[model samples]
Target: MDVARDRGAVAIDRDECKGCGLCVEACPPRVLRLSAELNRYGYHPAEYLGSGCTACGICYYVCPEPGGITVLRRQVA
Candidate 1:
């Protein structure tokens, strides 16, 4: 099985997100996407694609909603 190598990870807060798509657009690796399913607020929330993240925190900075996005960088051994 082939696994995608990721330098970082993203965590999206579904409830906090307003489906603005800013983070998705700002993502450098294009690893973020809007969910097909609507959130409780009847909006499509942003989600992480599980790979290709560079942990640049662009998503977090671009997101208008506080706590909507969290970027985690991989620890160097």
Candidate 2:
């Protein structure tokens, strides 16, 4: 299996997630998923699936909570 090491990155705030699965469903690359572990709020937070984040901001846009998903877009120069 191929996993992205650091090409693209996304930061998920576990504490703020409500396990709505919106971000996961909105992710075009399918890089986000509900973590098996629970967060402080006892919800299955969205987690980065290794790599493959395109930084499209779909997850961020769909996320109901602010700052829930932070997308670090790959720099192209």
Candidate 3:
């Protein structure tokens, strides 16, 4: 997990997403948004605008493909 802005947050690679909708289905905060743009593989995957996330890792764990989701929490430094 990576840290961002001391908000216990991380970054997500929207391009790597496969649009399986599992992440969207699993997101507890409803942070992940389905992009209208489709990837090279022809799936309209999910995208995070970095606003609605609640730091829940449901999207990360439920994603069928690897790198489809990433969860970052702030390090207690």
Q: Is candidate 2 or candidate 3 better by lDDT?
A: 2
Cα lDDT of model 2 by residue, 1-77, tens digit: 25444456789989999899988888888888999999998999999987787677788899999888888866676
Global Cα RMSD, each model: 1.8, 2.1, 4.1
Give the whole-model CA lDDT for all candidates, comma-separated: 0.89, 0.84, 0.69
- For candidate 3, the TM-score is 0.73
Tens digits of per-residue lDDT, candidate 1, 1-77, equal 11246778999989989999999899887999999989999999999987788889989999998899989998887
TM-scores for candidates 1 onward, in order: 0.92, 0.86, 0.73
* Model 3, position 20: C-alpha lDDT score: 75
Scored by lDDT, the top model is 1
Per-residue C-alpha lDDT of model 3 across residues 1-77, encoded as one tens digit per residue? 23244343435566777777877777775667788998887878788756656676777788877786777765567
lDDT of 3: 0.69
Give candidate 1's total backbone clashes.
Answer: 0
Show where candidate 3 strays beyond 4 Å: 1-10
